[model samples]
Target: MSRVYLSLGSNINPKHNIREGIATLNLRFGQMQLSPIIESEPVGFIGDPFINLITTLETELPISELSSQLRLIEYDFGREDNAPKFSGRTLDIDIVLVDQLEGEHFGLTLPRKDLFEHGYMLYPLSLMEPELIPPGQEKTVQELWQQFPFPEQKLWLTEL
Candidate 1:
């Protein structure tokens, strides 16, 4: 089985969406390792604040199939494919890292760029998989997280 790390977030009915989303992922992917959920102000859009976290699961599906599966879950919770990139979401799930594979696969950059850009994503990732080394990175997630400029952003630990 391939180990996969995913970032999950929601702003629209965030608490309900996040809990249900976690249940669904657990059912579909078997056991999962979860980080502490975080509540944060939305990025690049004016809307309700979002709750975000990282989860690690083991799956036999390839990258494309895993992406497709996650999309299906998002769709079930009202995600619209045509929605603006920065719009509020019922649920948003993205692959952060899958095994050690690098480069573009199914149009996704390995270790999605948002993983590096967002404190909400990176902090939880570091909590869940502190030792992870994404492709092209010489430092572990924990190490990179230490250097991240998070003071410019606001994120709070939240309970689901």
Candidate 2:
């Protein structure tokens, strides 16, 4: 088994989508420690703010299998297949990291490059694993959160 962190989001029926996403994830992968939800203005799309959350869990499935499962959850939750890039959606689930291990498979890499660059991922990540230090980075999640420059977007716990 490996400790994997996932990022989930929705701009459409966000609250409901988040709740359903959590339930689906738990049912498929067992227990999880969820971080708080964040309501942030759409990054590239102009629309309602998005509700984003992060969760860390242990899974026996391989990284590729886990990614596939998450993709299925998103599709099952009503995500569109041919939506405009970065446009608001019914759901988005990303495999943020898989422990400290980093390797390439099927032309994709674990610990997504944006994971260390975007506050969207780091903010919620800090809530669940404050002390986790990204590989090749000197800062912890909490430390990175402190240094990240994303504007003051609302972040809080939601009824789950």
Candidate 3:
């Protein structure tokens, strides 16, 4: 089984989308380790804050297949075909890590870079799995989250 970590976020009907996303993860992937919902100001496009959460699961599917499944789930959650780039969609699911797989050439190395760059991802992650260590990163989720400068924004404590 692959230890899969995914980040979920939405600005439209934030609460419902988050809950639905969790339900989808459980129904499609496997049992999920869901984090509390966090709210952060729009980073790229201009809009309302985003309700973000992290989910870790053990899946037998390959990483590529998992990614495709996640994309389909996004569509099921109301993602439009021609949605504006980063314009606060109904659901956004990003693969944060897939085991220790790495790449030397043009391919996806395990542990997505957003783990450190995006506080929204790291913050909730700290809450979910304190011992989570992204591939190639020495710091655990708790350590990284502590290092991150908590953005002075809103984050809701979502119940799963």
Candidate 4:
């Protein structure tokens, strides 16, 4: 089985949606190692704050199939079909890391670029797997977090 780390977030009806997303993922993927859900301001657009987290699960499916299932799960939770980037979402799930695979596989990029750029992605990732070094990156997630460039970007652990 391949170990995969997933990034999940929601802003629209955030509390309920985040819970539902986690439950659905648990049902679909079996038990998971979940990071604390965190609250953060929307990154690209003006909107209500979002709650986010990272989850790790073991899967027998290949990267492509796992990625497909995640998108379908988002759709089941009311994610808009053609939502603009930076728009509100009921659920947003991405494959942030998949084992040690690098570059693109089956049309998806491993170690998603967002992991390096977004606090929502990196912070929880650090919590879950501080020692994991994403493909082509020399530093661990904790190291990345320590040197995270955006001093102003912050994340708060939520009760949810």
- TM-score per prediction, in order, is 0.95, 0.90, 0.86, 0.96
Scored against the true structure, residue 141 in model 1 reaches a CA lDDT of 88
Q: If the candidates were sorted by their lDDT against the true structure, best first, what order would they fall in?
A: 1, 4, 2, 3
Instruction: Candidate 4: give the clashing pairs.
Output: none
Better of 3 and 4 by TM-score: 4
Ten residues in sequence with the least summed lDDT for candidate 4: 150-159
Could you report the Cα RMSD, in angstroms, for every candidate shown? 1.1, 1.9, 2.4, 1.0
Deviating ranges (above 4 Å) for candidate 3: 104-109, 149-160
Candidate 3 lDDT, tens digit per residue, 59-159?
88877787778889999888887987769778999888777765431245557777788888888889888897777878898998777765554455645
Candidate 1's C-alpha runs over 4 A off are none
Instruction: TM-score for candidate 2, please give it.
Output: 0.90
Across 88-146, the per-residue lDDT of candidate 1 in tens digits comes to 99999999988887889888898788888899999898887789888889999899999
Q: Report clash pairs, candidate 1.
A: none
